[model samples]
Target: MARNSGRVGDLPPPPEPLAVPAVDAHCHLDLMDASVDEAIAAALAVGITRMVTVGIDLPTSRWQAEIAAAHPEVRAAVAIHPNEAAAGVDEATFEALTALARADGVVAVGETGLDYYRTPPEQHAAQQESFRRHIAIAKDTGRALMIHDREAHEDTLRILAEEGAPERVVFHAFSGDAEMAKVCADAGYVMSFAGNVTFKNAEALREAAAVAPQDLLLVETDAPYLTPVPWRGRPGGPYLVPLTLRLLAQTRGTAVDEFAAAIAANAERTFGPW
Candidate 1:
């Protein structure tokens, strides 16, 4: 899962630091190449003051909590990612995640939801069941829900409705068009765009960004994956958030500082004060 393979190299030199600080709404510190401390420092230098590191499995969930516990600038989001759900979430895994959901500095339960892209039809049922349980966990703990919807937008929205979403819901690396963005807009869900939104072929994603209400806007690295354009194939970290943020502001015809301030506020509203 680590693109940097456990060693931090020269990441694309960071883009210009935003005048107003922002938060990396979704990140995977555990899977990244940099040491946790290095990642935090790099992000801070670029005005990405806080990060919510999400987990995709039991071991990684525990690591998320631990990282949050050790760093003031980091918050933790715990869940079994939908892809990981294919293997099934047994009792022990569920119980541990529930407990982690209530841990201090644990601000969310997610990187959950559905991912039909890589999963097969036989496992769709399992992913859905796991997603439902995660929704309940988020509600029970009164934490935000971070969803990872990948090529399963319809089912993801449906399950959220059936199970009832938490007070705060964020679609991490939101991969939807303007129409889907409207649906999320109407639902008052936060849509966190990532570096991929800057890709030349991601017109639909850009359209979604253009139409999304400022209050619903958020940005992340989803690193170390989907590194922003001009630096796409490079291993990424929280520090690269500025590239995506600037592009989103430009697409929406909004001032960079104003856009940056709004997104920072949204992150606080969705994940609480970091």
Candidate 2:
């Protein structure tokens, strides 16, 4: 992922901490400029007590597990991202990815699913095959299934149904509408909204947030990307999570502290205790 060209000025000033502890259920800590110890301190200072760093490929996924092993405050989710899968993820690739998914401190197999937005029609089959393989890996490991569903919701959902979704499933940076939210809610899939939910043009996403069951809601920065509003275009870090959490709380008409607590609990359930 590319960072803003604005240098240090591109990093947003940290928002006032939530005071109540919360977890950034999904993020790419390795993608950010900060070291793990530095990022953890910044997040701790802001009451973002725990973070789940996600990996988009094998090497990064292994790094995720290594960092998680070293830092009690961090956990990891590993998978070949949808776009990468579209490029052609062979069984050998999945074999290695599967081994990583079962590693210690690695709580989920994910950020894997269909992405029609960037991938062209010709590669759709490859993407779907990789998604199914990841689904199997998640189930096999008895870990949560982290999904990256973008403009391919119907197929994403269909694949899950056909593949028999693992007991736990999360739609990272969930991009669906209220109807899709309902489908996810009814199917017991967790929707982890990223900073993009704060955008003014995201009324439909806001609607989904408003109607989503509180228990099923989680929050993330997807940092180094989707940096939340007021800090839009700024390079994001875990420390900036308060901005998005506050926005999500307000959107749901919930108290900030209470909402934060719920998200923390949801994170624990989804990724296990941090």
Write down the lDDT of every candidate, Cα atoms only: 0.92, 0.89
What are the per-model numbers of colliding residue pairs?
0, 0
- Please give each candidate's TM-score: 0.97, 0.96
lDDT of 2 at 224: 72
Clash-forming residue pairs, model 2 = none
lDDT of 2 by residue, 192-274 (tens): 99989998899999999989999999999898788889877777888888998898898888999999999999999888876
Best by lDDT: 1
Candidate 1, 1-274: lDDT as tens digits: 2435443345789789989999899999977787898899999999999999989998898888988999999999999999999878898888889998999999999989999899999999999999999999999999999999999999999999998888999999999999999999999999999999999999999999999999998999999888998988888999999999999999999999999999889989998887
With candidate 2 superimposed using the best TM-score fit, by how many Å does residue 79's alpha carbon deviate from the native? 0.5
